[model samples]
Target: MAPPVVPEAIARDYNEGAFVLDRSPRASAALARRCLEQVLEGYLSATGSDLKKQIDSVKEKVPENVYRGLHGLRTIGNFSVHLNKDTNTGQIVDVEPEEAEWTLEVLDLLFDFLFVAPARAQERIDGVNSKLKASGKPLIE
Candidate 1:
């Protein structure tokens, strides 16, 4: 079984909405983190991996590209979660609107890729395969 494709139109609309909202970079980052957390929870549930163990295992099994994606989410998520502190401490020195917009876009991409797309695909694939197996049907046609 494979996950269904996410329509480009939906993706575009989602991105556009985010842009229209003009959310602060910090808010975008927080939302991205929440999305990532949902994906992680779904992955763990599907795989039946112990939460603590899975977190540790993912650190090693994730490919470089995937790790990079997660890192982006983490950075943005952390930024948003600690926005006030970061801003006050001068950790986030840039306060320009454009820069903030760019940050939001990046975070949105990260969340969509890491959480929404993959999870949905995996769920679809798994569900189809499970049904076929239960019906005593071969996976391949």
Candidate 2:
């Protein structure tokens, strides 16, 4: 049997974002935004909802702090996208490296909260239930 897998879309975007971080912060930020979007979409879908097509959906789906973090990620990415475009028109608005980097940091926290911690908790629950069944104890509800 195949091992269980966490979704890879966010991870892929994070990798690409990190890869471009030094050279083009704007591109990196864009990928970070993609990661955040995919994570939110996954959360919404897990709750039997369809994909969250708008940025505001994060606010609706998550707690305030998580929503804020996601919003921050989006804001940085938006700045990068808009500023880069402005550069083409002789308007140079810059996205610092730190701004792009912060998105990845926030993503790490979200991944743990949204994916890793839950998976671990579920595994622990399954193990406890298995032991209870083997011992003739009533399983947890």
Candidate 3:
């Protein structure tokens, strides 16, 4: 099932990222990072130019696991673009299969924290309220 997103653009990039994971981990990482940034900045109101700083603004706002995991993903996605690497072998730096899988896992964690668990919890709360109303009992506030 498609993960719930605040906007369609985020969903588009995220799904497209997952789609290209096997063929190109770099693109997958890029799109995943882009989607992450959008969710943080656009939805959560994180402020900053780069993902690192954007992440920084909201680090205290999210759970500890989300904060820790974001850094790992940023490293993987920004390696080729941001980090300084050895130029001796002239080898291209790209994301590995494990890294791509890990990024997806991180995305899952973030989505579950931000959207899924809350939605499910709300549904259960509403169900209880409905039962309470039918029984003429006090509803949970």
Off by over 4 Å in 3: 4-7, 80-84, 87-90
Candidate 3 per-residue C-alpha lDDT over 62-128 given as tens digits, one digit per residue, 9 for 90 to 100: 8989888888888887863555455986666778877976777787888888887888999999999
Q: Which rank order by TM-score, best down to worst?
A: 3, 2, 1
What is each predicted model's overall lDDT from 0 to 1? Answer: 0.51, 0.72, 0.80
Tell me the spans in candidate 1 whose CA falls farther than 4 Å from its real position. Answer: 1-21, 45-56, 83-141
TM-score of each: 0.45, 0.75, 0.87
Q: Cα deviation of 136 in candidate 3 (Å)?
A: 1.5
- Local distance difference test, candidate 1: 0.51
Best by TM-score: 3
Error of 2 at 140 (Å): 3.0
**Candidate 1 lDDT, 38-112, residue by residue in tens:** 455654332335423434446555555554655555555555565444445756532344544544454455455
